[model samples]
Structures are given as C-alpha cells and as structure tokens.
Target: MRIKRPRIRQKIIFTLERQLVKGAHYQLLLLAALIGLISIVGGILVMPSGEPTSTFGESVWWAFLRLSDPGYLGDDQGNWRRFISTLITVAGYVVFLGSLVAVITTWMNRKIRHLEQGLTPVTANNHILILGWSNRTIHIAAEIFQSVGRIRRFLEKYDAKKLQLIILSEEVSSFQMQELKDHPMIGTRAHEIVLRTGLAIDREHLRRVDSLNASCVIVPSLAYGRKELISPDIETIKCLLSLNAEAQAQNNQDLPYVVAEIQDENKINAARRSYTGPLEVIGSNTIISRLMAQNIRHPGLSAVYNEILSQVDDNNLFSQVFPELTGQPMGRLKRAFTRAVVLGIVKSEGEHFSPQLNLPDDYLLEDDVLLVLLAKNSTDLVWRKDRISTDYAPMPFLGMLPVEELENRINILVLGWNEHVPALIRELCTYEDEKYFIRLVGLRPIAEREKELAFLSENGDRVVVENVVADFIRESEIRKLAAETFDHILMVSSDRMEEEEEADARTMVGYVLLEEVLEKASKRPSVLLELSDPSNESLIRRFQSEVIISPMVLSHLLAGIALQRELNSIYNELFTVGGAEIIFRNLPEYGLSSGKKRFDELESLASAHGETILGVYLDRPDASGNHLLLNPAKSHEIGLSDNDRFVVLTTFY
Candidate 1:
C-alpha cells in the first residue's frame, strides 16, 4: 500500500505538470487556483493575530492584499501577522506574478508567430482576390494600383469605399510579402494588399479570403518555373470549381467577375465549362506568341505594345457606349472628341463582344455599339457635342507615297525553345502571302522539335523550319548560325533550366553571344528577347534590342480586363492577324522632307489614308532622351526629318 501511494503521488505530479504546460490558459487557471488556496489558508492562520481582520471574509481580504502586493507587509502590526504576510507575499511571487508574466509572454509570442504565418482569415467584401503565386503576381498587383482610377469607378457600382487586393498562395513567406510591397509600382499602395497562405483548390482555404464576396478574382497561370502535379490550365479550372462550390455553399447563384489565365489554348474550353459566371480567360501562350510573331514582322513594334499595354502611359484604350452618337459616321468620331481618338467599335454578340476595326470612313455606327477610344484618361472620353456644317472639310496633305513592297522571304534565327515556340511558328504562318525561313537552334534533340512542330510542314511554303541541337550560350555555336544573315533574331528563355532566374541568366548569356557574332557583320538584324523575370530588365537595358517580359505583359492584360471586360476584344483586334495593326513609317515614306509641322496637320493627312498618327519616333534622342513620344498634344509642333518615323495605326500592314 505504501509503495502504491508513492507511485500514485508521482503520477499525480506528472499529470499536473503536463496540464500546466499544455497552454497559457491552463497555466493561468492553475495560477488562479493556487492564489485562491493561499488566500483561504493564510486567512485562517491570520484570524487570531489581527485587529485588521475581524471576520473570515475580512481575514481573507487582509491576506489577499499582502499576497498581491509586497508593500502591504510593512503595515503589519505584530510578529505573527508580519510572518504570515511575508509568507503570502513570497508565495504570490512564484504562483501569481512570475507564472502570469511567463504565460502572457508565451501567449503573445504564439499569436505573433501565427499572424506571421499568414493563416489568419481576411474580412473583406467586394475586394479583388488574386490566387496563386507566380513571377507575374507582383506585377499584376502593380498594374491594378496603376489603374486605380478605373478601379475606383468599378467600385462605385458596389458602393465600396476603398480598393483591396487579397492574394492567397500555397505558401506565404515574409520575404515574398516584402518583395510585393517593395515593388516600385506598388510602393505606397501596399496597404491595400493582403496576403494569405493556402491552396486555391481547397474549399477551406477559399473561405479564408471570402472568395464569394470578392468583386473580381484573378488566377495567374503557374506555367513558369518548376512543373507541378497538374497542368496550369487544369489547376486554374480546379480553382474555379472550388470558387463555384464556395459560392453555392453561400446560396449565391452568381459569382463576381473572374479573370483567369489559361496556359494552353485548347484547355480554355474546359475552363469555360467549369465556371458558369461572368468570366474572362486569357490565353497566355497565344498572346505571347502572337506578340512575338508580330514583333518579328515589324521591328520596334515591341516598344509600341509596351506603351499601349501599360496603364501608367499617357494614352490607353477605353470602350464605352454613347447613345447620343448612334447615327454618326465612324470617321467623324475623331472630330467629336478633342482628347480621345476613336479606334474602333465593339459589337455585342449573343453573350460576348467582338471588336470591329478598320471600318470604311462612311460606316455608320448602330445603336448600343461600344466605341473603343484611345485617351489620356476616362475623363477625356466625353463627347464634345459640336454642330459641324456638312460642307466643312479640312485640306489633306498630298505627300502620301505608294505602299512599300513586302519582302519575298525573311530569314529568322531562333535561339532556344519554349512552350511559345510552336505557337509562334503557327502565328507566323497566319500572315497572308508572307514567307518566313526560320532556323531553330536549341539544346533539345532535332527529332524532338521536329515531332513537336510536325504540323508546320503543311505550311512549308509559307514557313521553312530547320532545327539544330546546339548550345546557344556558347559564342562558337552562335557564330555558326550566321545570325547577321537573318532579318530577325529571337532569343527565347530556355525551359531546360529549373529556376526562372537561372533561365534568364542563360538567356542573357545567349544574347551577349548573338551580339558578339553580329558585331563584324554588315547587316544588323532586329533582336527580340523573351525574359521571365522583370527584375532582369535593368541589367539588359544597355543592349540595343526589343525585350518582351511575357509575364509582365500578361499581367497588364489580366489586370486591365479584370477592370473592364471590353479590353479583351480591343487587345485581340490589335494583336490578332488580319486586323488593324501598328506600323512605323519614315518621313520619306510619307513623301515629306525635313520640316516642322503641327501634329494636327499630320493627323488630318493620315485620316485621308485610313491611318491614325499615334506619335513620332525621333531620329535622335531629344532633351528628354526619349526615342518614342506617343499621344502628344494635337496642336504641338514636331520637327520632322527624313530619318524620323511616324508611328501609325493602320490596316495597311
């Protein structure tokens, strides 16, 4: 029995210690119990020794004062009372004061650690929800900030006070959060961003961001970097399914507008079937491929796209329906708005809108048709409401030259291969009556690339492809390609590498080798580079080449379309084949020599030829060191020279 008693006592002590260590709440409860025990016991002991305590309750109060504060010990009357007060104060230090401090400190630290983990739920309604983390995440957030004016108007329909961008990713690190906040474009507006840690496919995680309540949800394609379990488009569809399920759970029949990026064009149909809501799915590979193919045909057009896609630029595309201008001819729209340039019209289909550009001058606009305009801001899109005489006509410049001849065939040197390569080849084949001779140099086997592009053989007369497996990073291999003989050189980011940064590093080295090979040649071909990392833009600025950060461009589209759905068709018309395109022509091509002329004069002259004068490309950098100036004041005078070019939007290309 004695042996069993000792064992039981040991077991009881272990149980108490386990309970005390479980959590701060349990430890606090134990401290409170100990304080109660000491007050009662000490009160009984001090009852006979006191004039300060008469009854049992008063005696308990006397003991509690000394236990809670050691200063009460000095006021004790006699020897017994003083000894009891000292004993209670000593017990209070261990049981109440010390333990309470430790418990509170531990609890606070635990809360802070949990908060840093980004697991806490966000309480926001009508906010922008961004799912997944890729190279484009920060840039997407930045563009949203740049387009705040449009977003504010978007929020007005819901009567929301401020803009909020909430992002949920598989993992959230302090470093990633800091990177997003520290981006130059998202600098001070970081307060509007909220990041959480979770997977988009998980319904439990979707609830954390209140996905059903978001004004718009954006799912960026995770096709870059390391491969995942499922394809990027599949993953995006799964995310949409989860969001749909979440909305169903809340008894909400409709989800807010959603803009999701699809990596594969074929999978877009599957994605559309997955989410039956107001949705816009951006085909990332198609967009990038088309832009690259367009830049190959028109050198320096990449810069034009960069300016047009950026919201921070002075001019941007906006679409709105003005009922007052129903019966007006399309050509007279330019005279109606002083600050806005009428680009095209968007006719509504059953459930979608299609952009109709390059219409004849006498084309009359129908009712409820949306006009696509290029303007500095939304405020400049208002109609002037002017009454012009039917006989009024401005004199046109007679300096128009005949159309230039298209080259019979262009030799293109492609360094490295990626997912966009096949799509790029297909896009180049879409041009009518144009020929391209493409020489592909990559690290992969020639047989593999041949199999990948087996369909191109059908268009062999239009595009000739020759694949050679060689390391483009080596200067010797690059020299063998005879890069200078080609009319254009495309350096695609290598997919053979694991990390984006490592892949970009390889691309930079390849660019250097290509430049070295071109130094001794007579012909200087246009060089276009596809880079994944936007941070690498600064390092390669010294090279005279057109750079396409594919992810950044996609981000701009995603953000823009999320704000306004009509932009989807506008971008499609601009980039797609057999549509209105941007082209640059020299002053001599316009049959004009060195002279100064007002920009409005150029605009009026271009109107006669079914072209819009966007801006000027300087022969030499001006005081501002700008090579391209777009959307200048119409009345502003510009010095024109034979070497200078005019950037125009026309279907003539």
Candidate 2:
C-alpha cells in the first residue's frame, strides 16, 4: 500500500502559490498592462459615436497622446473628435495617479525600514552583522557564529536569550551563494542564528536586518587575496570612507561600533576613518604574525593556541582573569574561573608574565586585561567568598618543570610568500631550543629576512635557513629537493594575487604535495599552512596541524577585537610580551589519564609555587579527529595522558 503522490497540476499550483507571495510585483505589472489596454479598447469600440472605427495602430497613437499630453482643442470641437478624446484626454490626471502609486510604494519601503530598526524577527536586536565578501568571510562568520552560539547557550541558562548574527555579502556569483546555503549550524547559539544575503553596501538590504541597530558588527579579514579595481590598500581606503559617510548620514557616525578588515597594513588609517564611535579589527594577521612565527618555531604551540582561539564550548576557550582571583599564580587561574582555565596574564608592571610564577603572591595581571580561557565569552566573576572558605584545595608542589623539558628542536620547510616572514622568524629565534633546530627551506632569501638572519647568526644563535632551490609548485621538484629534510612543513602566500589563475595553480600544487608527503611519511611532520584563503583552512584541516590565515579577513577581526574594551589589553599582554610563552605538558597528578579539566588546580599549586597553568588539551572526540577542546569546566575531569600546558610567564629573550 504505497501512498499516492500529488499530480502534476497540484504540484504546479503549490509551486506557484509559494512563488506568488514573493513575485507578486511581476504578476501585477502584467495584469495592469492587460486591464489598462482592455478598458481603452473596449470603451473606444462601444462609444455610440456614429463615426467609422479606426485601426489598431490609430488607437494606439491616440492613446499615447491622451495619456501623456492631451492637447485640448477649442471647447466647440467637432463631435467625432470630442467623442474620441473626452474619455481619456487627461495628461495631468494620469501623471498624478502614477505619482500617487510611487509615493505609496516609497511609504511602504520606509515602513519596512522602520521595522528593520528593531531586529530581524529571528535574530532580535542583540545579533551581530557581518559585512563585505571575502574568503575569510566564511571562516570568520563561522567562528563568530560559533562564538556567539556558545555565549548564547551560557546566557540561556541564566537569561534565556542569546546573541545572534546576520551576514551581508557582495553578490559574487551563484557558486558563492550556493556555498552559503549549504552551511547548517553557523551561529550555533540557541537564539543565535545567521542570515546571509548578497546585498552589499546598499542600505535597503541592511535595513532588512537592522544593521546599525545590532549590538555589534564584524567585518572579518580576507583569508585569501580578493581582487579589487584599485590597489587593495587604496580600495580599502575608498570603500571605508564611503561607508563612514553613509553611517554619518543617519547620525550614526559615532553611534554604532564597526569592525572591518583591511588588506594592506598601510590602509589601516583609512579603516580608522570609516569606524563609527568605537571599532575593532578582529583577525589582524599582521600583528598576529609575530605570534604565529613564534608558535610555529615551537612544536605544540599550535595545540595551545587552538584552545584559546576556538569557539567550541559554552565556556570561552579564552577569558580574562579578574583581580579578585588572588594568591593563585598563572597556572592556577585555569581552574579558578568556573571550569575555565588561564593561559597567561598581562602584568600591571608590564614586566613579568610567567604561567609558572610565585603563587600566594599578588598575581600581576594586566591592569587593562586578563587573558583567560572559558567555553564562552565570560564566566560569573563574582568572588565566591563562601566557596573560598569552604573549598580551598591545596596540593603540595614538587618542583618547577624547566622550559627545556619539551622537545623543541624542529627543522621546518615553508613554501610560498608572506610579508611577515622576517619578523616571524626573528621572534622564533628567541626560543633557544627551536633556534638551534630550524632550517628555512625555500629558494632565495627575502631581503628583509637576510638582515635579521645575519644578525641572529652573528650573535651565536644557530639560525640557518638551508634554501633548497626549487619551485614548491612543481610536483617533481618537491621530491627532488630533500623532501624529508625538515621536522615540520608550512606553506604560505608571499604576495597578493597578481592574477587569479596563477595563484590557484600554485595552491593546487602545494595542496597535492602536502597530501603526497602525508601519504608516504611514517612521521607525518606537523604541517601548518598559511593558505590563499581562509575558506581553504577547512580543506587543509583534513590533514593536520594546518591553519590558513587570510590577512584581509583577519584585519577585520582585529578591528572588532580592538573595539572590545579590555580585550585589546589582554591580547597585547598575551602576545606582545617578549618572554611570554605558552606550552603543553603532561600532568596527571591533577586527575584522569588524558583530556581537558584541571580548572581547579592552580590555586593551591600556585600558592606553593609561582607556576601558572594556561590551558590543557585532551584527545577529545570531535569532527577534527579528537579535537583539543579548550577551557573545560571544573567538573570536567581528565585522564593521565592529557597534555597540561603551564605558561611560565618568562621571556624567551
């Protein structure tokens, strides 16, 4: 007994009904033409004027004149002429009627715009608005949505509402639109949701979601190089200026906060001009390069960072530690803030930032910021005076685990170009162990890097880059150029795209080579990539230890984050401190074999010793092969095999 399906007639009716609501204007225009034609023709044929009927062409010509500028002859006109003209002879009247219709349409549009000021029915007023189109648009939108989702979930338990989001993009093409439609759990918040549109700088589409009225706006960096009419820097400058002009017209110039990405670091001044009131740059790859270069030189640094940056849990992967969290050193901060953890802190003195600092001592947190780890945005920072008295768990500290404990020596092979390579490698050289182990693999040395390299080597630091002369894009050359010469492999884009097809070709070759190496090598060297586009980040993650940073998109993230009060201080403390380093170590004395949890350990341990536990990583189950989940809760227990990274707030210098 199979159920019968709807017939073709029924299906067509259903489809038409669905389309009619949205496409009514098209249908109505057709109807108006038909009705207007019929009224004129029918009235003309039936008129009782005894004169012979005119041809169709004659009727059309007369109708046009009457509708547009009916010229009146003397009142005592001939009967045939008067009869033919009287019924339709009002030019001003028709014009007035059409103008009335247009006015009504404009009124309706204004009303819609007014309603949009409140919120999208789904996202509400507290949602996020992301603008512009770029490769990193997808990645930033995804991460932001996930971040907001986690924040929403946390709020729902307490307030029953969540942060939401809406994204605006340029109508690039059908393929990009198709890509947007395919994503399901973007925002990841209960009330947190996302709506994507091809509408760009147009105010009408922005009015659809109340762009200015939203709590925040995020314009992410372009993880990949996007084409522009002018130089990317100049185009960024001009577009930002125009955007600022629009926002100003609404008296919202300094009212709403804005976040945007800039391609060239040089164009940052223009981004400043575009920002209303307060603005932030979310993914500032330029500044982040110093950190990336430092992290890459040190193995397992990626693991520690993935925890801080990821938006995968209810507790923020990274958070700020409050001043009241006293006596505990950096290592203990991880567990004190709910089940959340601490990586490090910017000190008030701007001097020392050691995870393994002296505890029971005044924890020197950055006066402006405290870098921490939580599943979501923040945890309840109220000092539990009651809990402080009731649950003070103290553990006897054995001794300090020296920084030299981990295997740091690494030989890295990097492909492609990056503007920040010189500064990046320079920071890496500060790590003594990593400094001795690196061999830069590429063709000619970048001129900027040459000065830094010579200086480091002159200072007795073993900074050597064995330039294996070969094209990384050529398949055969990769095998011929000492493929197994390094401990880790990285690929980056050196310059922006001069031509689209050429860049794509280069990326494809690199991707294949990476995959090929993965297939054959027994020890799949840690592979990290700075890809052409942020969207490509997803593609490469399928391998391992891979991250693609889009400078264009990240510039926006940086802008947004910069807008966040106290967050910039935290970021500066976390990254700018010369000696500050984050590491993952094995410590089961705090519980289970492997995986997160250790959120509560820092207090007593730090009370005895000055060690700060930044964060912990576990082979936690996730779509990305046992994801290293960040900022687990206090209740969340861990096994023995887990890697616990204690950030010793000390400089590599």
Candidate 3:
C-alpha cells in the first residue's frame, strides 16, 4: 500500500512539472505562490524578543514588508529572527523579481519580432488593396500616387487627408518592404501604406486587410521568383477563389471591384469562374501585341497612346453629359464646346456600348449619349451657348481614298517568342488585301511554335509564318536573317526568362546586334522593341526604334482604373478592334495646302472627312526634339508640310 501511494504522488508531481514547462504564465504564477507561502510561514515563525507575541496576520504583514524591502530588517533583535528576515528578502530578489523581469523581457521581444515579421493585421477602411509583389508594383504604386496628386491639384472638395494602401504578399521580406516604403515615389506616401507578409490565397490573411471594406483590389501577376507556380494566372485564380469564398461566407453580396492582370487570354474565362463579382481582367500580353501591331502599321502613334493613357499633366480622355447640346447635329456639337475636341458619341447597343466616331453631319442625338472628348481637364469642357448654332449647313460625308497597296509582299521579322507572338501574327493577318510573310527567330524549335499557332493557320491564309531556330543575341545569327530584307523589325522580350533584368538585357543585346547588322545594309527597317522594364527605355532609345514598355503601360491602366472606374470602358473602346482607333493620316489627303493653318480650319476639314483631329506629328523632330503634339489649342496655328501627318481618330472600316 505504501509503495502504491508513492507511485501515485510521483505521477501527480510529474504532471505539474510538465504543465510548468509548457506555459510561461503558469510558471510565473507558481513562483508567485511560492513567494507568498515563504513570506507567510516565515512571519508566523519569527518575532522580536521585546515585542508581544505577534498574531498570525501581524507576522504575515511584517514578513511581507521585509521580503519586499531589505531595509525592514535593520531593527531586528535576535540572530534567528534576523536570519529569517534576510532569507525572505533574498528570496524576493532571486525568485520573484528576477522571474518577473525575465518574463516581461521575453514577452516584449516576442511581440516586437511578430510586428517586424509583418504578421499584424491592418484595420483600415476604404483603402486600396494590392495583392502580390513584382517589379511592376513600384510603377503601379507610382501611378496611383500620380493620380492622387492630380486629384489634389484639381479637385478641391476631395478628402485627401488619409490615403491608405494595404499590400498583401508572401514573398516580400521585412527588409524589402521597408525598402519599398522608403522608395522615392512611395516614401513620400509611406504613412498611407500598410504592408503585410502573407499569401493572398490564405483566408486568415485576407481577413486581416478587411477585404470587404476595400475600395478596390488590384491583383498583379506574381513575380518571376515564384517557381512553384506554373504561371502567374494560376496563382491569381487561386487568390480570386479564396477571396470569393470568404465573401460568400460573410454573406457579402457587394464585393469590392477587382482588377486582375492576366498573362494568358485563354485563362480569362477560368479566372472569371472563380470570382462572382465585378471583375476586370486586363490581358497584358494581348494588349501589348495589339499595341505593337498598331505602332508598326502607323509610325509615331505610340506617343499619342502614351499621352492619352498616362494622366500625368492635364491632357486626358473625358466623358461628359451635356444636356444642353443634346439632340444637336454632330457637326454643330463640335463647335458647341470651345475647349474640348469632341471625339465621338457613346451609345448603348444591347448589352455592349459602342463609340460612333464618324457620324453624319445631320445625325440627331436622340437619347442622352455620352460625349467623348480629349481635354486638358474636365473643367475645360464647358457649354458655349453663344457658339451653338442650328443653321449650319449639312456637309457631305467624305471618305478617304483607298491607299495604294504595294505589289511586293510585306516582310516582318519577330526576334523573340512569347505569348504575344501568336496574337501579333493574327492581328497582322487582319489587314485587307495585304500579304504578310512573318519570320519568327528565337531559341524555340519551329515545330513547338507552329503547334501553338496551329489555330491561326486554319483561320487565316493571308499570313505565312516561318520559324528560324537561332538565338537573335548572336551577331552571326542576326546577320544571317538578312535584316535589310524585312519591312519591319519587331523585338519581343523573352517571357521564359525568370528575371526581368535578364530578359531586358537579352533584348538589349539582340537590338544592338540587329543594329550592327543593319548598318552595313542599304535599307533601314522600322524597328519596334517591346520592353518589360521602363528603366531600360533610355538604353534602347539610342537606336532608331519605337519602344513599348508593356509593364509600365499595364500599370498605368490598372492605376487609372482604380482611381476612375469609368476608364475601363474608355480603354476597352480605344484599344480593341472594330472600334474607333487613333491613326496618323496623310495631311494632303484632307485637301489642306502645305502652309500655316488655324487648328479650327484643320478641325473643320477633319470633321468634313468624318474625323476628329487631335494633333500633328512631324516626320522629323522639331528644334526641341518634339515629334508628336496632342490636344493642341484650337486657335494655335500649325505649319503643315507634305511630309507631316495628322493625328486623328477614325474608324478602321
């Protein structure tokens, strides 16, 4: 019986020891109890010789004071009493105070480490939410700041006090986060940004940012460092699914607007299936391909697109509803607004809205149609009641003379292979009565590229694509391609490269090699280069080439949509096919002499031809090295040359 009792007591003692080891708080509590017990027992056992026998409560009180402060032992009388007092005081210092200090220090360090790791949740409302981190994020952040600056400069009633942006990303380290905040463009707005380190697909992380209360969520494609993911689009879809699941769990019917950048156009439908909300998918590769094709066909048009896309200064695209000018003829509508150049009328057709750019002179506006105009600012577009006149003569609809097609087939050389290559080939095939001979030069095998582009071959017979297996960065291969034989040289950045700097460096090498090869030839082809990073723009500009920085352009679009939601529709109308697009038409075709003419006269002549003139581009740069001017004043006189071209908006058909 005695042996069994000892074993049971040992088991109980082991359980307490395990508990004390498991929890710091429990250990602290046990230490406090031990101090109290020692003080109470000591107080009862000892007393001064001259004093009356101390009561239990009085002795306890005396022991507590002595334990707390060693000075309480100075008046002790007997050796045993003094020894007990000193022992209590020493126990207080060694056991109670020491453990308390150590526990507090450990707790504080743990809290600080957690915060430094960016695990703390953010509690902000109406803030912009940015998911994922990449090289383009810095540009996106810059564009957003620029938009806010524009609002602060123009709009007086806007509440510009608290501008907040919460970024959620798993790959962003604490040092990297600090560096981003301290960046020149971002550092100025550091107080407004909150960064958290967590995967976007994690529900707990999403809850931390209060996703339901966000004004907008921008999901950028994942950075190239994420090797586990097959592609950025897959990661984006996962995030969307997680976000939707969270929203559904909370019964939130009104989810925030989500703008996601997708790399592959085919994955758009899959992304849409994940989120049952207002989603805008920007196809980065598709849009870049379209822009490249457009720039190739029409020289110096990239500048106009850049100006309209970036709202850096005042020149931008604005849509206004002028009830006063409603039901007026299209011709008179132009003169009614003195400040803005009325581009077209936006009318709804079924579920989609279309822009009518080449309306007849006497066409009447029935319902309230949105007027698209290019102006410095919205305030510039004011109703000029005095300028409005109903008695204007109806002008005949003028049509541009068909351009004479060359007898020879057009040859285009593509220097790299990417997702955009197929789209570019399809776009090039769309030109009427034109035979396109496209040669794809890259490290990829010809069979693989052909398999990927098998669908295009079945649909179109106008484009003949041939692939050459060779690295364009090699000077010998560049020389072998016969650079002088092609009409256009298109350099595409390699998407397979994981690092943006490495991809851009390869592009630079290719361009340099191509330029060296072209120098020895008699013919100089028009060069159009695609860049992933805008920082490389200056390096590539030394060559006579038109540079299209797709990442920067996409970032601007994302930022613009976040700031003004209506911009999504405007951009869709402008960039897509079968819509009004900006083009450079020959000035002489409009019947204007080669001399100085008022912008209003040119505007009237353009309106007569069913076109809206934005500005002009000299074939050669002026004294200030300026080639393209957009949104010029109406009264400003511009000298025209037979070589110059008119920048105008006209229908493709």
Candidate 4:
C-alpha cells in the first residue's frame, strides 16, 4: 500500500492556521491589506464630477487619508464621493484600526506577563548559572560573594562592572527571587543576579540563560515533591547531559565547568559518564557522614575544616607559585614565611596537581611546585626577612606523653536514623586501636537495622552495632537507652520530615531530653547535633553541643569548588581517610611549661613529634567563647593550661 502525503493546498492551510494561532500579528496584517485594497478600488470608481479627475496614485492617497480619519468625508464635493469615503472609514474602524489596537495591546500584555513569569531570556556573558532552586541556593550564593579573591579575579578578567549570577528554576516564586536579590550578603556584593523560571533540562531554557557564555554551572540536587520517582542524582545527570549536548551542538570551544550535587553515591558513576567536560559531582550524604564520623573521633575538628573551607575570614588555605624559593628545602620554606604557615607543596603531576604535606626537610622543592600556605589573605604570602629571627633554638625530639587512663571501650548513642547512618558507621570503623559500641535508637524495624549492621560488622573490625526500636521524641524512650553510659551522643536529623523546622524541632526535643538525663550523672557525655537549617545554629548554640549543619557545609563546599576548581583535590585529601588528618592533642602531652611559650617553639616541638602545629585551642574560652585560632603570628605568646589542646596535622587518625 502506498501512503499519500498531504496536498500542497492542505499544507498551505495548515501553515496559515499555525501562524494565526501562534500570534495575532498575522491576522491583523491580512485585515489591513484587505481594507487598503477595498479603499483603493472604491476611491478609483466613485469620483465626484465637480472634483478634479484623479490618477490611480492620487485616488489611493485620498483613500488612505479618508480611512485614517472619518472627517475627510466632509470635504467631499458630492454625495457619491462622501458615500465612498464613509464606506472606507467604516471598514477602517471595523477592521484595520480596531484590529491594530487589539494586536498592539495583546503584544504589550504578553511582554508584561513574560516579565512577571521570568520567561525573558537573559543577555549576559561570563555569568555563573545555577540550575536548581532550594533552601541551600541562598547560602551558596552568599558563599560565592564571600570568596573575595575569586570574585575580584573574575571581574578583572571579564572587565565587567559586576559579576552576574543567573538562576534557572521553575519552582522559585517572584517573592523568593526578590528576597534573594535583597539579601544582605548577596546584595552587598559587586554582582547582579537574574532569575528565569524554566526547567533546567529544557534546551530553550538553557539558551535563554546564555549557557554557552557562562563561566560555570551549578546543578544542585532537586528536593521537590513527596517521593522522588526520579531521584535527584538522575535529574542532575539529565541536566548535565542536556548542557553537554547544547554545548556540542553550538561547537563551543570551551565548555564551562559544571559542579553537580548528587544524593546517591551509586548514581555518581552514571552522572560522570554523561558529561565530557570538567565536572565535579559532590555526594552530600557521603561527605557529611565522613565529616560527622571524623568529628566524633576528634572533637572540635569541624572548626578546623570550617576555617579552611570558608573565605570570609583571613585564615584560609591559599596556593601560590614562588619562583624564588623553587629549589629551597620544604623546612626552609616553612621558616621563611613568619606570618603564614606552610602546609604543603602543590606538585603538578601530568594533568592534575596534588598536595604533598609534611615533606622531609632535605626534600628540595621543584620549580613547578606551588606552595600551599595558611594565611589571613593572599597578600600575606610575601616572605618577610625581618620577621624570621635567629634567636629560636631547636627543640629535642622528646616523645609524646603516655595516654591518660580512661575507659577502654567507647559507647556511642545515635538518636535517629537516615540514609547517612550507614555511611557514618562505615567511616567510624576506619579508625584503629578503638573499640566502638554504637547503639542506634530509632523507629525502624530491628531486622532492617540489623541488616545494615551485619554488613558493617562483616566489612569492619572492632566495631559493635545495636539498634532499639523506639520513638526518640519521647523522653522515656530516650532515657531508656542509658544516656549517661554512652561516651558520646549523636543526634541525626529525620529525612521523613520534609519540613526543616519540624525535623529540627524533633532533634531539639531529643537534645533536651538527653541533657536532662545526663545532668544528674557524674560525667556528662559530649553531644553532636545534626541540623538541616544553618540559621538555627544560633538558637541551638546555648546547649553547648557540637552542631553540624550539613546543608550549610555542603553549600560552602560547592561554592568553594565553583570558585576554584583546583580546590576539589584539596578537600578530597582533607576529608577522606588514609592521608593526613586534622586531630587535637592535649597541650600537656608536649611537656610544655605553664608560662608563656613562643609560637615557633611550639611548632618546633610539634615537628619533633612528627606532626605540624596549626594552632591551639584554649581550655578556657575567650570573650566570644571561640577556642581555635589557626596560623597565629610567630611572635605571639600562648599561655597554656593543663587542659589546653593543640590542633595538629598528623598521619595517624
């Protein structure tokens, strides 16, 4: 059987119908043409005998004047001419002028609606494109502004008055967009933000934002809807694929870097396979679990990570090339910078650069290596010869003091359960010479909990996992777990509660109940509280617990990575196990005197113990109650207490 195509006449009709349905301009143009033809014919045929005989051009001009204004008919010398003018004027009012006004008004209304709906395509170059909407967007934007060095470099390179940040999302409302623009942190920056309401995976929407001209793109995992039929990882992967396809179609010479946040670790491999450009996939749950486990093993370690990660303060990790000190030994390089502490060398190997920390004193620095230093600002990277003194004497290699006698078994009490719990358990198991007896108290079936526990037990040694089925919100259930018996208490946020406020409220209840239970005990265990919202940190600070806001941490990390792509390696080395880790050792273990000690002497003392001293944590809090101060001046004197702690970087956990 032969299939027949549509006839030419049918195809023409279909095209015209589509044009008319799409816009009113085509219909208005056709009506105006018909009215002009009628006016011209009528003017030529009906001519008054008293009036001058008119040529075709003259008659057409007269018809135009009469159609434009009905008053032109009064000047007619005869009834015939007046009747013709009246007919033309009636046609003009009924079709030409009437339709013109309708079309113009409709076009204007559409433009206004497009503006309100954020459908207008943004015309910007070298902008940062954020492709999703969530509570974390505001924080992420703030962090970008806080990165002063990165912003300044971007503005200088583009010769732009202000950097642009374009947010493309269908879920954000006008009010929310306005709120973000008016936020104190973001509004104060030398930047402008544009909002476009559309799906990230849509190619047209990508074009609207000028994605090809963007400097970078951020795809935050979507947290919308009750049950994610399509997981956030899958959505992020789809967005990445769409962006890659668009860039490929455009034949872009340089595709912008993409930093995507994914929830599932298993899906990261799939997301990676979808893009060919420079892509960074951050698994928030996995990283948070690693951070939480690290914090549990070493208290106040989160502060160190926060300081290094954030750029709001002067104490941040910075990498710079020092050509003059290329061949200098690593030890000499460390001593050269009195104001800044040399952490490691960033050695470029093949296509990537990795941080080499705690290098031997005799190890000479290569010309291609960049020094990583902890300083208040990049401007402080300059070496000051006057700051280095010859008065400081080398300290002997006195071994660390014996460990304080304490309980051999460590008890950990977890008050809630989420997807991060399993990862947290596995991370906790990585530490050696520690016996961990972890008890989980949640509202899940014991069998299900044991399944995860069984897996961890088989994979890790020296860790015991147990679960108790109960509503942790109830004080009776919380007390039944013997809160005082545990050495550490961990409060996990509930993922089932979609509302951040509600989830935080439940966490708060559990924290208060545990506080009451441990009040009567002789020894009060340390508490680690996980909060979804960072704004609530101030509210919960009075409880005097170690609070970790996972969303805020993720926001900071994403912002850092977006600003400096090379920082991805630095963070990976800092967070994960099997490398140099941040740990706090008691000051008394170093055998220092009670009187004031110079910062350099302390650094030398720490070096003898095969560790690098970053800073000290005072046992007694200062005015603001902050105990940690990193990379203090060499001349600064520290009055150490028996309980004071030293923040150091060592190979051991």
**lDDT (tens digit, per residue) of candidate 3 on 151-219:** 443233234355677888675465766766766666757656677888888888899778877767998
lDDT (0-100) at residue 117 of candidate 3? Answer: 69
Top candidate (TM-score): 1
What TM-scores do the predictions have? 0.90, 0.60, 0.84, 0.82
**Worst window of 10 by summed lDDT in candidate 4:** 398-407
Q: How would you encode candidate 2's per-residue C-alpha lDDT over 1-653 as one tens digit per residue?
A: 99998699989787666654554365455445644674466346434443332555555545545544446434314666565566555432554346446645765886775443433333356566666665555555555544543355434533536455566655434465456555453422323334445344555556655665666666554444545464444544444454566677777744445556554455677677665455544325445565566466455565545434432343333334465654444433433456444445433333223332223333444444555443445344433344444344446555554555335456677676555555456556655454445445455555644664565655354566654445687667777655565677767665556543355557656767767756776666766665554345565555556564444224334432522333444555456535445544445443335443344543345334445554444444455565454444555454434344433333333
RMSD of each: 3.4, 13.5, 4.6, 5.4
Which candidate should be chosen as best, given lDDT against the real structure? 1
Q: Tell me the spans in candidate 3 whose CA falls farther than 4 Å from its real position.
A: 1-102, 116-126, 148-164, 175-185, 223-229, 336-339, 348-352, 358-361, 364-368, 376-386, 389-398, 401-407, 622-624
Error of 2 at 441 (Å): 6.4
How many angstroms is residue 161 displaced in model 2 relative to the true structure, after the best TM-score fit?
Answer: 9.1
Off by over 4 Å in 1: 1-10, 17-22, 40-62, 77-84, 383-390, 394-407, 444-451, 496-499
- Model 4, 199-287: lDDT tens digits are 88888889988987888898887543436477667778888888889988999868878889987677889888888887888887778
lDDT of each: 0.83, 0.50, 0.76, 0.76
lDDT of 1 at 385: 61
lDDT of 4: 0.76
Order by TM-score, highest first? 1, 3, 4, 2
